[model samples]
Target: MIIIIAGIGRIGYTLAKSLCDKGHDIVLIDSDKEICNKVSAEIDALIIHGDCTKTKTLEEAGIEDADIYIAVTGKEEVNLMSSLLAKSYGVDKTIARISEIEYKDVFERLGVDVVVSPELIAANYIEKLIDRPGILDLTIIGRGEAEILEFIIPEKSKVAYKKIKDLGRPQDYLIIAIYEGSELKIPSGDIELKPGDRVLVLVKKDAVDIIRKMFLE
Candidate 1:
């Protein structure tokens, strides 16, 4: 994929590195010359120093042929303008990093392909640490209507000694994977649940409270 990224801050730099490592064609643009020089020296992608919201600068970054354009600058207006400009230049997809809590609906209504809020993402991650410390991580999908969660089995869990299929998990929920130490295994009907195992389960969002009461309580 040909990806054009605007901004060279921590999030942008890390994203560029990870995507480049996956073998994507990347073009990184930032107005700061020093940061551009540093990032260009470290990554194999093309790095340009320019205002991302400007058409000429975006042209220099090859936005006309880009498959994806991402704006991660700290300023919400700049990010939005960059993404909108990329879209105008025929980029197939555009994503913008947003900071304001109230502008999300407006961004979606304006047809931004994706909007990521660092604050919201960080808050959600922290919530996992406090609400379900036993879970490694959790993802809410379909507008928070469903979720996939990772949980470690405690010694006293009621299902610890039961067979996987005999745990009485609701029909709408499913245990997808099990991690025993470093090994990850797919759960099967006959597989026996054990203490010290980590499990990933998919469930409806509304059913989470019920599931937690039955298993974690």
Candidate 2:
């Protein structure tokens, strides 16, 4: 998928890296030319130094061909304009990050496909979304008290060959399911986790380090 990201802020950059690592074609836009140059050498993506809210800049970023356009700048107004411009160019999906919670309805009413609020979501660039390789995805819930995580079991994981019930997991975290190849299996007590399998877990945020020590270390 061809994804164009505007802003290059913390969430924007992290999202770009995550998508790029997943083998997607990515084009990044930022007004700061220095950061553009710095990011070019670090990630496998096209870096465009320009204001994403402008028509010429969006055109230069090839917005029409973008499968998804995301605006995650600190300024909600810029994000709004950039995503609207991308939608006008016929981009199928558009996502915007906004700090102001009240504007979410307005953004959606104005044709933005998805509106994300940093305060409401556990994905507030909070934790390991791109902080580690095997940890595929993460979401914080209960106001940072708990987290939902999707992690691929590493080959060197301590409990890879162990049964779900045999691991002596703490009460705070639960192994929700195991994904093997294309199939999803409920984590039965007898189900032995495999190295290549992906596991979805819900854990207390404070106890995540223990979960990592077992599955990601």
Candidate 3:
């Protein structure tokens, strides 16, 4: 896939690197020449030193043929304008990172494909980390109707010594995998949950409380 990334800041640079590593064609644009050069040197992608909101710059970056266009500048206005321009130029999909909460509704109303608020995402992540210290990460899918949670087995967990199938797990929730130390293994019915094990589980939104009671609490 060809991805055009606007703003070669920390988030943009990281995203470009990850996509480039996956063998995607990435075009990075930034107003700061130093940042553009620095990131270009680190990754195998085309880097252009120009403002994303400018039509000429975007045209030079081949926005017309872009599969995905992402605007992640710190300024919300710039990100929004750049995304709109990308869409107008025939980019297949446009994603923009916004800082102001009020603009989210506007973005949705404008038919923006995706709008991400780093602050909100970070706050939620931090809150989850604080509330569930054993949880390594959490991803909401099915439009937030379902969640995938990664948790480390605590020594005091009730199910720590029990077999996978004996935990009385609800049908809506499924244990997907278990990581014992450095080894990742699919959890089998006979496999016993042990302390220090990292477990990945998929649960429906309605079953979240059950998951909390069973694993978190």
Candidate 4:
């Protein structure tokens, strides 16, 4: 995929590096010459030194052929404008990083494919950590309406030593994978769950509270 990223700050740099490592073509736009130079030295990606919101700069960054365009500059206006311009330039996807939660509706109405709020996400993550002590990890899917959660089976849990088939196949969630010691396996109906086994479950958002009571309690 050809991805164009505006800004090379901490968030942008980390995301660009990760995507580049996955063998995707990346082009970065930033007004800071030093930051661009620093990133150019560290990664194999094209760096453009110019205002990302400018049409000429975006054209030079090959925006017309870009599969994804992400704006993560410190300034919210710049990010929103860059994303809007990228979409106008026919970029397949446009994503903007916004600091203020209130600006989300306007950005969405302006045709930004996605709006990400780092602060809000961090706050929610912290809240989840405090609320669900037994949850190992949580990944929101389908616009936060569902989740893929990683958890460990406790020794005293009722489900321990029980075959998955006997549970009548949980209607609200699906056990996707299991990690027994060092081995990871896709769970089957007849598989017996053991204490301390790490499991991955895809669950409906509304059913999370009930599932937690059944397994984590």
Among the numbered candidates, top TM-score falls to 4
Per-residue lDDT value at 123 in model 2: 49
Give the alpha carbon lDDT tens digit for every residue of 1-217 in model 3: 9999998888998899899999999999999988887877799999999988899999999998999999998898898889999989888899999987789999877867999998988887688668755667888786788889887878888888999889875588889989999998988899999988889999887886678568755
Which structure is stronger by TM-score: 3 or 4? 4
lDDT of 2 by residue, 134-208 (tens): 667887676678888888888898888998878866586998878999999988889999989989899998788
Predictions: Cα RMSD each? 1.7, 8.8, 2.1, 1.6
Give all candidates' CA lDDT scores: 0.86, 0.87, 0.87, 0.90
Output the TM-score of candidate 1: 0.92
User: How does candidate 2 fare on TM-score?
Assistant: 0.62
Q: What does candidate 1's lDDT look like per residue over 182-213, in tens digits?
A: 99898898888788888889988777766655
lDDT of model 4 at residue 39?
A: 87
Model 2, 189: alpha-carbon shift in Å? Answer: 6.0
Q: Model 3: which ten-residue window has the lowest total lDDT?
A: 208-217
lDDT of 3: 0.87
Q: For model 4, how does the per-residue alpha-carbon lDDT over 29-129 read when each residue is reduced to its tens digit?
A: 99999988988999899999999989999999999999999999999999999999999988889999999999999999999989999999999988976
Error of 3 at 42 (Å): 2.0
Candidate 2, clashing residue pairs?
A: none
Using TM-score, rank the candidates from best to worst. 4, 1, 3, 2
Q: Higher-lDDT candidate among 1 and 2?
A: 2
The ten-residue window of minimal lDDT in model 2 covers: 123-132
